[model samples]
Target: TQGPHPVWEHGLNGRGQVVHVGDTGLDYDHCFFRDDSQPVVFYPQKNEKHRKVLSYQEMVEDDGTRDHTDPYSAHGTHVAGSVAGNSIGGNGVYNGMALEAKIFFTDLADHSQSLYLPPDFDYYFRPALEMGAGVSSNSWGSNDVTTYYVDTDRETDVFSYFNQEMLIVVASGNSGRRMGILSPGSSKNALATGSSGNNMMTRNDLSSFSGYGPSWDGRIKPEIVAPGQGIVSAQSDGRVNSNNCGTTSKSGTSMAAPLVAGACALIRQYFMDGWYPTGVPTPSHGFKPSAALVKGMAIHSGHPMQGRLGNRGGMLKGELPEDAQGWGLMRVDHVLRFADSPFNLHVENNVTLKHRERWHKCFHVDSGTLKVTLNWVDAVAAFGVRRTVVNDLHLTVDSGSAQWRGNRHTNDFETNNIIETVQVEGASGTYRVEVYAKHVPVVFPAGQPLALVLTGKGLREAACPQTCGHCVHGQCVHGQCVCNAAYHHVDCSLCDDDKLCHGHGKCHDEHLYKCTCDPHFVMDDCSQCEAGWYGPNCDSDCKCGDGHCDTVTGIC
Candidate 1:
């Protein structure tokens, strides 16, 4: 939310987006919860602009006790504010990341602000899914189990795998230790977050309280970090014992989680508005980026940190996405790529892969940082399992004679994790980044849906014919040649049959890419006239009169 007013002015502050929250409970009556300055209204009324929470419900546990039995959280209110609360309550100062976005709230807490997933965790998910929320922000987790893929973790991953389009954001707990991220945060598909100081861009100022992790199963935890220390957000009137609208300054990984979720709201909107591929939302190239794609974009956009805090957090691994900082801190602009001139960004978003199938992008890079990120929503692993990754996809980048494998040295690609990232100082040559399915136990026939994001300074997806053969005037998208209007076929090697010589002449060969015009007209398309007039070019003046005419003889 840095310089948020300008972000709103640019129309990138999460307009036309909705993020759901599963927490203690949201203060629906808070002024910041309302859009603009209008009064708040309860559920079922459908307040389009005046209110921000599109749906709200309290969870009823399997034991027949409601979550409202516990004291309501001023903390949940603060977290929701950080996600989508308006700045009106803060007098325009304490704005959420996606200020214009709406939200759905599901109370999942019974005892306190800390989260507790019941036996029927699906109950908390129904309200948001029914309301069509694309993202869910979870600020609580079970820190008791360490970073294992426990039942909660499996359930979280299973729901996302089944839903496909929904992304759940979780917070790394406050405990500061290696491999100490909480459950659900340890969920394979969750966008787990760490805590960074507010003033910094990188994790150089990473908070000491922020949780650190490389999950028990070897997946990097807290995929990104954001401003979590001393963050200010809207406070609930009832929780603070005041009826007047107010704001509160809080800290923890909880605060950090919502900031990332808010950023995702903007990222989701960028896609829905069809502004991502080429930044043109006019006709709307919009598509819902699968959870894998959006998660890849956010994690890929993060920047690494450097300092004592960085050294301590990162432990000088000489590579990115280590335990403490993960991929670094969130950079919203990098995801949007507003003008398209700065970074050479390319994405194969939501493409399916089969067993032993290889998907690759061949490009050339001059001298810059090259990063390849792969994310997939893996199938659920059963409870009490030593391994959690269900469908393993291997990532390798071949640059010249050197090749870099993702999570190098982990070697357990099959059971490693669902995300694999390869980053290197790219040389000046053809670079091929390949994602090969290693052990796709499930998703047969249909293929496993996944996303790959690539970016660098001078990276160019230059070679098309190498991957897609004979693609004349065509660009490859999603493993297929997107031929221009003039070309067609599997490789886009064929030209238009009806448009050959404008139907005025015969075609010698489609691959020749030339239309042999009739005696009447001449041009590439046979659209123009030669020195002498032909049949149609006669214009009812020449003596051809729909009859054959030879220019050499001038006879019909």
Candidate 2:
């Protein structure tokens, strides 16, 4: 689903996007960094793909120097190729995600002392953001610790909280499920990933080396799983030609993260191009989504795995936010393919909530199940503080007859994690979704911004909007005003441009709509996979990346 095949058909291949890579090294001269149409692996001295590697910095240097000719190791090159590689050299057999996204590299192999101590998270990421990179990928971490909330933990949260648009994807280290977690991977805001087998359909498919959560603070880390075992990608040999560059297979959570990074690039581009409401972008329809919104969409669309293990190591039939798999394997196709959902979906992209103020929204759903997900970039706690969750919040789903709190993992209410989800099944009724400031010791003056996603079958809007004394923003559907403002709520059932496009634009219809193929996908024929690479011609099922869908649900 994330291979940019059919996604390329929808006019999204990570054009006009840049993601930062924190790694040991990067081979900037690789031939796989170009488009799929290039048959020959030989690149010119000044190739257009040279621009693909935006900027490179050395994070390990103590005195701050650049070795322009320092050939990178195989890991960084593989990670980069997995993120934005094309199959030009591999006969379209090994394509990467987001084939057009630019890369910003930060080399962390200088053997600096700070690498052993607490990291200055802000120091590592801010420079990349200045280079116009909002998304980041980190596939390296310390494996010595079981579970610990170090300074890097709070720093990661601090950087994300302050830079709300940035989405950082971290590897959960190869510390195994029994081990606690790595430092910054356990950070509250970063999207920590675990290792999943090629097809994560059963418990047997989960990786034995993948790290599980129940973090030091007792919150679930490794929020999602992806394929990382026996994955093949471009290998580095300090050459930009196909004859010199080779392919290698590696297994670790490190391999799983770049896939998520590339998938996020496509997902990010989906919203950036204004393809959400319709196939085009108008004034009201398209705008940048917060990092929390992207993270929530990934979680809400995830297909919950079966045979999850309990705390005592016994098997549990079905579990929400399982320790081993978090919210199950990522099913990004379910989110991008808006028409196939079996439930109604609503989104509040950028909701800024103040301290001590409660945000409430009421909706109606069927008797089957209701899933509400809340994700935010929380304000960071002080360093050396055992309690890393500084500004705590809780989500409660109320039906007047019964109530369900969000992610009651270990605490009475969730107090350690920045992401919370409450899924409940009950008789049909009007349900209220509340985001309460359970405790906010440290508060941002502008208020903490969060994203909310609700999905359920037979879903529609109930009452309770205090704007214009009624609903004037969105059109009424199914005998109720379902489509509210995007910041307020977005209904999935509404297909009209007027109702759906009003998300970012609020009721302004003056802007014209046009779809130009300037910087969208790579070329005219978007399929990068060759005729017999993985399937016949590219119409058939060919996976350039390593994720396999669930057998029952068909989600990846």
Candidate 3:
């Protein structure tokens, strides 16, 4: 289920999408890169002289010095293969999530250098955007020791906010139980990913080396986790003797990031391909989901794992711990299933919210839970600012009698998304969801863009009773009030008459009928115990300090 097989079976293979991978250069001649069935379009490198450039600045940077054919550095090739590699060369054993998706490579690491600085956001992100790439995969990050040297930038945030289309996926470094995440991965707009084990059923545990997180400002850093352990992918030149002819296995958050990036491609293609679930209504024109909506769907569909392993971090209060597993392990199947759920309603585009503005929706629910999530890529703050939430939106759910608020914790103030869940156990009523702008940034001229998803159980009609009498201490099952083992009556409203003693005991019958005997009485009917005995059926004598004693209390 973690791979692309399930998604491809639904006829979505990311056919028209382009994903950008930023790492060491790829081996262009690898058979996995060239498939007649679904050929991958490679981004023209600086060395390609005849390739057209978008601008003069891009043309000047095309110095042809970057060698994309380096076989020694197989990291970038492995990452790309895990993303969009085809089955033509690997005998269908090592196909990526998006087999038909195009690949765009950006050389961020040189094989000759041992230590290289992280690439600027403009170096790869801007290029991917210019080429109309909807998703970008980044498998590199700065080490924990170099945190002081890396400057947090607002470029990714600015691009995501203005563009509102492309998604950036970054690897949360393989630092294990470390407190903070890797550098560019900590960006507010990017989807920071941690590593899960390869086994999909047991993916709740994070990889031993996958980084843990709470960003510097205390927001959940790695928003999701994916399979990364011992992932088999294509190798450069087919000469590396690690595994089968042209494939090798690698483990790290680097391997996990591309899986998510490929998933993003499939999600983008699902909407772009005009594929809507059956019985669900669509507007006159096919709707396209925003990047924020996609991010929200991924995070909201995550399955929580923090409490299962007794690894509950102190900061975590609810079922999910933001610092440990973020939303939880990534489940693309759950995301797709949620999209097809009849009860769910997703916003197709971003909606602007002015100061003090509100949006509301009413839905009916019965005997289950109601969940609502509001997500947005907030405006980027200055590099060193402690607070990152630029536009604070509030989510509230009213069930007529009570109301629940998202972000209910008093101390948390930095996260950009809000999720609210209400329990409607055995209740039948209409619930109202309200989203309001609590704090809007003055810099946002038009207003903040937001995406909302409403999903959960729907209303269920009650089963009718046949006799039409009041049910007591029991519920109607198959048109009748089912009684407990100790009671026998039509509506389960009367005590068991057979268990009542002859003026010696009292019958109690709330949950079930039972008898409380008098001081000298014992037995099911309280008709066996005599003057000298007290126990049930007169099996034991009353023990007291004196010879003469009361039967039940054993008082002298």
Error of 1 at 148 (Å): 4.7
TM value for model 1: 0.76
Taking the tens digit of each residue's C-alpha lDDT, what string does model 2 give over 320-362? 6777788777767656644444566677888877655578788
Off by over 4 Å in 1: 1-9, 35-46, 59-73, 110-116, 201-203, 239-243, 309-318, 408-415, 442-445, 464-556
lDDT of 1: 0.72
Ranked by lDDT, the better of candidates 1 and 3 is: 1
lDDT of each: 0.72, 0.66, 0.63
Can you list the residue pairs that collide in candidate 1? 522-528
**lDDT accuracy of residue 513 in candidate 1:** 50
Model 1, 1-556: lDDT tens per residue? 4553434555787888888987777766666775445544334344555558776666565588655322434678889989988854544578788888888777776554555566755666655676778889999888485545677787788788888888899998988764388888888889999887776453467787788777888777878888898888877655422334677789999999999999888888878887766755644578878888889889887877654353254443424667777888788776565554466777888788876566876887776678888889887776666778778788877654466777663323324767778777745667777777756654356779899888776667867334433344689675455767765433344454345555455454434457766555667677755644534433323367677656544467
**Compared with the true structure, what per-residue lDDT tens digits does model 3 show for residues 23-128?**
7666655666643333223344322231111111111123455344435547877888888887554545777788787776676655542324334556657777
Question: What's model 2's overall lDDT?
Answer: 0.66
> So what's the TM-score on candidate 3?
0.70
Compute the lDDT of residue 523 as modeled in candidate 2. Answer: 22
